[model samples]
Target: MARQCDLTGKARQANHKVSHANNKTRVFKQPNLKTKKVFDPESGQTIRLKLATSTIKTLDKLGLSKFLRKYYK
Candidate 1:
């Protein structure tokens, strides 16, 4: 699977790393992702998902059903 959040589609970002001497290096900033088993109240089941930390936080707040309705639609 790709390195991405299944729900929010968050992925690595291209950036640069700078040094004190003004040197720069190409870098990829990866999202904070985790494999989680979230309970879906509507389905009465636990769904496994690869999600970003922010998405997980929002899931905790809005819940799976509401979150999917809000974002996944």
Candidate 2:
């Protein structure tokens, strides 16, 4: 699986590192992603997903269906 946040679709960002001598180096800024098993009380099922910490917090507050509806739609 790719390193990405499933809920928000956050992914690695491409950037350049500049040195004092004015040399540039390519780098990737990856999101902090974690695999989690989220339980849906309405569905009575647990779904595994990759999510960022922020998404996880929002999901915790809003629940699965509401979170998806609010963000995905």
Which candidate should be chosen as best, given lDDT against the real structure? 1
After the best TM-score superposition of candidate 1, give how far the Cα of residue 55 lies from its true spot, in angstroms. Answer: 0.7
Off by over 4 Å in 2: none
Cα-based lDDT at residue 1, candidate 2: 84
Model 2, poorest ten-residue lDDT window?
64-73
Q: How close is candidate 2 to the true structure, as a TM-score?
A: 0.87
Query: TM-score for every candidate vs. truth?
Result: 0.87, 0.87
Tens digits of per-residue lDDT for model 1 on 3-71?
999988899999999999989999999999999999987778998999999999999999888998999
lDDT of 2: 0.91
For model 1, give the 10-residue run with minimal summed lDDT: 39-48
**In model 1, which residue pairs have backbone atoms overlapping below 3 Å?**
none
Per-residue lDDT of 1-73 in model 2, one digit per residue for the tens?
Answer: 8999987989999999999999999999999888999998888999899999989999989988998789777
- Return the TM-score for candidate 1, rounded to 2 decimals: 0.87
